[model samples]
Target: MKKQTKKGAAASRDERRMQQVFHALSAPPRRAILKYLAASSLTAGEISSRFDMAKPSVSQHLTILKTAGLVSRDKRGQYVHYALVKQTVETALMGLLTDLGAMPPAAEDKPLAEQDPSSPTAGRARKSGVATETDLPPAEKPAPAQMSMF
Candidate 1:
């Protein structure tokens, strides 16, 4: 029981971390900025050229990205050059995906649901009151003749 409590606490901490990572990524402009940095570093002007948004609005997106540690900015001459922090971004996203039930899914040790074969399509299938993936029929391959008919 004590070990279970500790495990629960650890899981909660991990969930919170994953939430922060995903929350940072949920914004559209910030995602676009990351895409622009994928090829190479770009100046604020270069990034702005791709969108109709004002420079200051784009700058706000950059600030959000920096807060998430997804980008790094260097002042070169009169322009600030922004570059992708690829490793950090990838690590954070992958970590979040792993933490949110990807580590060990319901794939193992779960009892399968019982299904009624007489039920109509999209009918609920259950086994011991639980649904299993097999409740659905396998996908139908289109007939070659039918393909030609279309």
Candidate 2:
């Protein structure tokens, strides 16, 4: 086995941390907690109050968020205030978007249709007087059939 260098160890840790962040973000409750923390720091109780779930449940979600490095907690005498690690979340999200090629090109670049007519997306543009699915009315449901017991 090769010896692990400090940089290698750090990279491994970072990869694990990113995995944890993705896992933590997978749940709706945890995402909601992150959204709340994004606006302002709140105590566990304050955070719990926003959801219908039990305080412990909310706390569990907060714990996951905290473990992912997406949130940070500060103790102030009696209460522990939780806040979003905005930079980390933003960095992770931007990296994901970049990886997925979801970011639009700069203004200097032409639109896909204009740049390449042979591209599949270029030919998909709606022609004039065409009735697409959205233009049609909703289909009506049929009436239930009468049942007779013999």
Candidate 3:
């Protein structure tokens, strides 16, 4: 349940919303388009002309961004105008990172046990030569069990 306060209810991440933002930003061309929009909204053709890539590819990128809700498309006469929906992009990334504890508080206090028991990361910690708080014991090969037939 979400809590309500004087400043209106706090916003929470919706996975679908994140999927939209991440999918849109996954392509380099789409990120470039967003940067361009941050400067000023541009028509589809205007953005298309800036890139050496074929216009259809650019259109496909634009379509993805539009689907993700990171970009809004408006039909202006015969042309389509695209603009960044900044809030959605910023919110999605920050929310994802925060939830994953990539940033502060929880990140700083994370328990070493959270790491996968079988991951090579343990070797990195030891090879770093810097003593780690993790201090995982070196893995030992278990004795092979002999099969007994009755």
If scored against the real structure, what TM-score would every candidate get? 0.55, 0.63, 0.58
Residues 77-140, candidate 3: write the lDDT tens digits: 9988899986676567656767787855443223333334365555565355332534545564
lDDT of 2: 0.73
| RMSD per model, one decimal | 13.0, 12.8, 15.4
lDDT of 1 at 68: 67
Q: Which ten residues in a row have the lowest lDDT in candidate 1?
A: 107-116
Give candidate 1 regions above 4 Å deviation: 1-20, 104-150
RMSD in Å for model 2: 12.8
lDDT tens per residue, model 1, 12-124: 87566556556668988888888989889999999999998999999888887786678899999999999998656655654544457663433323222222345433345
Q: How would you encode candidate 2's per-residue C-alpha lDDT over 51-107 as one tens digit per residue? A: 999998888888888888999999999999999987577556655665577854341
Measured with C-alpha atoms, the lDDT of residue 73 in candidate 1 is 96
**Per-model lDDT:** 0.69, 0.73, 0.73
Clashing pairs in 2: none
Clashing pairs in 3: none
Give per-residue lDDT, candidate 2, residue 99: 59
